[model samples]
Target: MTLSFFDQFMSPVFMGIPLILLALSLPWILLPNPTLRWLSNRFLALQNSAIGNATQQLFSPINPNGHNWAILLIPLLLFLITLNMLGILPYTFTPTTQLSINLAIATPLWLATVILGMRKQPTIALSHILPMGTPNLLIPILIIIETISLFVRPVALAVRMTANLTAGHLLMQLIATAGFVLMSNMPVIALNICIVLFLLSLLEMAVAMIQAYVFVLLLTLYLQENV
Candidate 1:
């Protein structure tokens, strides 16, 4: 068969390990937020104030010595990788391939973009959304178009990821299903089809990572623009 069935279960678990490792490593290697520190202690019943202090020092994002947005990198990468793994697994679904999950990911990034924009230039945040200058006669039309596009950021993000994963996965499924249907009596032809499907699965893996990277890259670029 194309994947030996076991590969379906193994892929997501294998993919998830790096993500979990990244999450676990965050406390030791990154700087802490006092709010998160306190929350972690309270939730986990951590009693050692010295340890807490040490943990906080290690994990604090606001710390002078820590990398800016470094802590966030863990979750951001994990989320996308998890999404990709989800797409690869059989029977187990890829929620990221759905608009809902994409929206969940995209909306927050878009909000962060807005919040950062407002923080940097509150007075002109909304107005500065469009390019600096334009003809007076076209200003209103341009603003309307810009505003519409701004509102569609989440939609665009959602569609991009969902469509990519869905298309790739469906192509694989359809190809494999076709092989099975055509080669019900011919073992050799069936085997060849399985090989094609296996190759397609590999292609799907690449596509999954690419789509996730694109979404995250776009989010980063939007944030950079506002900053």
Candidate 2:
């Protein structure tokens, strides 16, 4: 059997069970569970420190009402970061690379923000449909455009994530394949390619982490507008 370049994105199965479930759940189990000891492990301390700093930077601008979303945002940020980093390992599938999964996650959260705004401040929410001091003729056009843009937020989020990961994964695969094929015939070039591949892998790791933070950060921004 031959392997397709895109096959990496597909969910694998073993003994009739999809491994996507494992991919989704494995990250949570790997996280450090709190213990009853007075002094925590250094790793746990580092983790807590990182979380605290991230939360401060992310939620500092929002009012107290929006601060309550830390529970939702922090876990999600960690989950995405783990999933993305895991996918970097050999033979692992990234759930975020799938648009359906991303849309499933992004749409409801985005809709919730909109709903919160409408529920908490209907005037402010409705007012978003049109800016103040608009010309009579432009009001309808502005409203239509804004309304369409409002609906497209989730799609934009899903596509941004899907595209970034998909493109990076594909590119990395292409480079690795070229290196493998050229190893015997063009060893010098292949050696250089290997060095490049190592560098690119490091960059991809950073991209993976940054994209996850950006995803949660955008959600927090949406929540801020609402709360």
**Which candidate should be chosen as best, given lDDT against the real structure?**
2
lDDT of each: 0.64, 0.92
lDDT of candidate model 2 versus the reference: 0.92
lDDT of 2 by residue, 9-119 (tens): 999999999989899999999899878898999999989999999999999988789898899889999999999999999978999999998999899999988999999
Counting clashing residue pairs in each candidate, in order, gives 6, 0
lDDT of 1 by residue, 26-135 (tens): 33433333454434655234434633453354345333332344456445654575557655666565656657657977898788877877787676667655566687
Tell me, by TM-score, which candidate is best: 2
Q: In order, what is each prediction's RMSD in angstroms?
A: 11.1, 1.1
TM-score for all models, in order of appearance: 0.66, 0.97
Q: In angstroms, how far off is 53's CA in candidate 1? A: 29
Indicate the worst ten consecutive residues by lDDT in candidate 2: 218-227
